[model samples]
Target: MTDVVAFLPGNGHVDARLSFAREKAQRLDVGFELRSVDYGAADSFEALLDSVLEQTSGADLAYATGIGGLVYLALRARGALTDQRAILQGPVLWGLETRTFPKLMRLPLMPRALTLAIARGPIQRRFMRKHFTRPLTPEFQRVFFDGYRDARAFERWFAWLTPRLLRDLEQQLRGRPELLDGLTAWWGGEDHVVGIEELRRTEAALGQPISVREFPSWGHYPMIDEPADWTAEVARALAAPH
Candidate 1:
């Protein structure tokens, strides 16, 4: 039996989607606990990392999906987490850094203001939905909507997503290839939120080969899109020898 810790996506808390891990654990007759770092409550990436470390101190393995995967990588790179093996689903590596903005939005003051504006309910909902290749169920809709409505949360998220932070993260990962030694990553070919280019960049930055599984039709949220497949991957990771 293995004790597993699952981290929620960037704007999410522990929710029903994580129940798939619980169910998988039961079937495998292994120990499993789902934990969350409240990204909404964090004032910055440093605070978010602190919360994750504080919350998930004694787990045997880490399971992180979406941006949470990236968070796990950051925590591991910083030596904040002790988990020997990690399962990362749809990790958002260099996507944030490569995001394109309109010429007008690039103007001073307009960028932050426009980001804040889009972080509001209606626009945020539309933007969040764009991450998926297919439509979301009602349950996921509520989850996404709730995340979008938390304006302060978006503020903190944006604040932590600066170019400086990206550079720091790259430097940390490149400087310590051992940080990514036991990671297994899953990526969706259809994922609009994180591109293959980002995955390649992540591999390059790691300075070593990484175990990655690619699903051609899956989108950004594979657990939501295909829970059974996601759970199966988790089980495989759990069963693999570290």
Candidate 2:
């Protein structure tokens, strides 16, 4: 099967993003069976990764965003996924350093209940706003709000952000350096969610150079903010020899 699996971000859904990916795949006439994985309702990080692995087991290509990219990398490392090519957009590879969280939220001593409360309350708006460089459209507002209000989803999200996940990711990358092969990274210059320096650190950890495409004007969600550019980039990556 010439399948392509699209992995959504933490607070994301298979709506406009997945539609855009499907549209691009159709436009390219690549005969890809496009599918999207939803992690919003997952109970934990491992559960989310398990769902992703199961969904994309037969995929030949994969597209992932934010933390979803990390999930892809982990699967690739574990030999759970054997996709020939992967397109990672603003992947959260640098662990906690890649994100901009409040000092209180990052504290190891912080209660999970307090963190969940903050995520569901005042911090939700800020968190959503950080993903876009422009104003929120009605559709995105609905998606963001729905995800933010789901307490269980926030718990899963927070669970993925812990230091243990970072350590595990690093070990995986180190153990399976081949995970970085046949991967193209797309990063937004104005992205507030991921740091450039941290990306460099991740590259060093991989011990290989990653092909990266930078969109200076776009934020975290380039597919939503710059669909044409994102599509063209994917097409180019797909067209390239593996």
Candidate 3:
């Protein structure tokens, strides 16, 4: 059987990382494909889930990062997880329920455009500076800006930011801990976005044992910071038998 590696990128310009994913698949002597959710076209969370599921169909292994992790959880909830083998890199699977801003943004009184405006402004860079351990590389920064040229996409993503989604996902995983089976999670010890502590909390909340890979020196975006090492590890995983 021909093996394939499907990459589900997070919200942002993922051209470079997508290329790296292809290289990793090549190292495993497998075909490669990218299945990023069309945040712009999806009008509802259901639509977003469908987009991810459709894109990931027929893959031997699926790798998701950031928001992509949420998509996978949603799939598991619906009993439609396409790939039997999957990896989550710094997934935002928890903690949204406790975040006030995302909750406020979803309230009827809040203007949806406000979130998009903030995304396009300096606040995002400020957030990155505060949360990430190091400055974004020039290549990563260029794509970050390029992604904003499409305002509609950001608006769609903002619409799905709600505490209810996180709560529901957590509940689903808690109810069926087996949903997490066959999944391996990767984290950068230095990644402030989803730190080691949050990972622990997620593990506790789910009460499921998740396979983990910790890289002490890496940060949030290992593809930008340590492409060679990151790809090497992913290649090894792809080559290993299930």
Candidate 4:
């Protein structure tokens, strides 16, 4: 029996990662597993590698769902991960510069920041329906709030990362070049995290139209927004090629 593994950065939500894989697995009639990088387990690079080697095993294919995982996919394409094929999804191109160093100009950030703060603050204990404490998704609020006993324990669990994360992100922003030369990118137009234009630019800069898929109304995490459609496209792409 063939299996497909879905991977993500440890800080990422398990619900989101598994939701993407399990939905697609059901559609493709394949076995699925959720693997996560363990950030807490590594203080240095060598230790990080050992941890990744321990957790990430080859599969029929691995769906690399975010910037951290997509970077790993490109490295895997170059033979770092010799045992599996990788699918890149909604990859973040400029993280340190665009995402964290400073907020992007045209988007709303204060709301998100406040949302996160209130979600984890003292008010969280008393205000179930308070505006600041509530999340975008009513059903998912508990998944994030109640899923972790405390933030510290949740952050330490996944101790491995797909090896390409920092290196690729570092290189690309330095204007080194496109790492997508031999990789396929899967994206959606409605994805707020990585815009459609960014994906187009990446595909163009790579000098080829690698595979691209778009959806309507589904933001960054379309697997959760539009599961059935995402599943259909995923099955088709996995069956296509490296």
**Which candidate leads in lDDT?**
3
The residue pairs that clash in candidate 4, if any, are 37-158, 37-160, 38-158, 38-159, 38-160
Candidate 2, 87-194: lDDT as tens digits: 788777765554545234555645365645544534666765776766656566556555444534544555566666667767777746566677878778998877
Best by TM-score: 3
lDDT score, residue 12, model 4?
Answer: 35
- lDDT tens readout by residue for model 3, 102-160: 45656663545554654554766776676555566656555665565443444455467
TM-score of 3: 0.78
User: Candidate 2 regions off by >4 Å?
Assistant: 1-3, 12-33, 40-44, 97-136
lDDT of 4 by residue, 1-242 (tens): 54455454423354443454465657666444445544343565455445554556655555665544434643543445554555667765434233541232223454244346646746554444332211245556555454333333233222222224435534443332343433556666555556666555544443446566555555566555566666666566556665
Candidate 1 lDDT over residue span 41-105, tens digit each: 67667877887777656766676765667678778778766446777777666665666632343
Please give the range of 10 consecutive residues that has the lowest summed lDDT in model 2: 8-17
Show the lowest summed lDDT stretch of 10 residues, model 4.
154-163
**Reference-based lDDT, residue 44, model 3:** 82
TM per prediction: 0.76, 0.75, 0.78, 0.60
List candidate 1 segments past 4 Å from native: 12-31, 101-136
Number of clashing residue pairs, candidate 2: 0
